[model samples]
Structures are given as structure tokens and as C-alpha cells.
Target: MKGFRFGSTQGAFYILPGHGGWEATYGNETLGEFSSPQQAADEVARGLTCPHLSEVDTSTLEIPEKLSDWEIVHV
Candidate 1:
């Protein structure tokens, strides 16, 4: 079965299709199960406290060697 991952410096959380619904996990540990992929991804984002992030200092930001730092990897 193919699924996607949200990776970080710490590790990665995988969102995959499972019995009856979608599953969000960090390695062998289950984060939660949801009825849709968006919910599963939202749960993980909520856990990471993304809403409270401070604004970045774009003045110092430089272009990455990659066109975009983000990617969608199916595993």
C-alpha cells in the first residue's frame, strides 16, 4: 500500500490507508486514525503546534538549492 510522509529533523510521521479509515503514525506508534487524509494530516500538524509559529526573518532567508524544500513522497 502506498502512503505519504511529513518528515522533520526529529523524524517522520506516515499517513497511510488502513482498515476502515486512515492512520497517522510515527514508526510503530499510532498517532490517530481518521476518516480522511486531511483530518489525519491536520491532527499531526496540530500536535506540532504550527499555529503559534513566529514570523520568519525573510531578510536573512536565502533560496534553497532545491527549487522548493517541500516534496510529496509516497511509500
Candidate 2:
């Protein structure tokens, strides 16, 4: 469904609609669920600030970055 996908040289993650709120997912595991998209994205953003995610240094993309990292979470 609808979600947000953003990343840097580190890695990428998703903030998709979950059971009753939002879910932050990396390579495989669903890190956690939050009551709002911003919370989920913030959580993923925290992990993105780290050295690595799921112990894998990735980001195969070599193109220019996005104009903005933020997304329309609601409305």
C-alpha cells in the first residue's frame, strides 16, 4: 500500500500502514509500530543515522538524491 521510502549512503527503510498505526521496517524485521507516520519515520531516521542497518552497509543507488526527504504522512 501507501508508504514512505527514503535513504542515504547508509540504507533504506519503509514506514507503511500497519495493524492500527504505522510500522517501521528495515531489511526484514519490523522494528516497531507507532501511532503516527512521523513517529515511525522518525524511528527509521534514527536507525539511518547509525553506521549500518541490519549489519549491512548498503545503498546501491548512484543517482542524485531526492529533492526532499520528507513525505506527506497525512492528508
Models 1 onward score TM values of 0.61, 0.58
Per-residue lDDT over 15-35 for candidate 2, one digit per residue giving the tens place of the 0 to 100 score: 778899987666566768899
**Going through the candidates in order, what is the number of backbone clashes in each?**
0, 0
Q: Give the top-scoring candidate (TM-score).
A: 1
Which regions in candidate 1 have their CA more than 4 angstroms from the true location?
A: 48-75
- Candidate 1 scores a C-alpha RMSD against the true structure in Å of 8.4
CA lDDT of each candidate?
0.55, 0.57
Error of 2 at 10 (Å): 3.0
lDDT of 1 by residue, 1-75 (tens): 566665654456567887899886665767678897677765565453221224322112231222123234565
Among all windows of 10 consecutive residues in model 2, the one with the lowest summed lDDT is 58-67
Model 2 spans > 4 angstroms off: 47-68, 71-75
RMSD list, candidates in order: 8.4, 6.3
Ten contiguous residues minimizing lDDT sum, candidate 1: 58-67
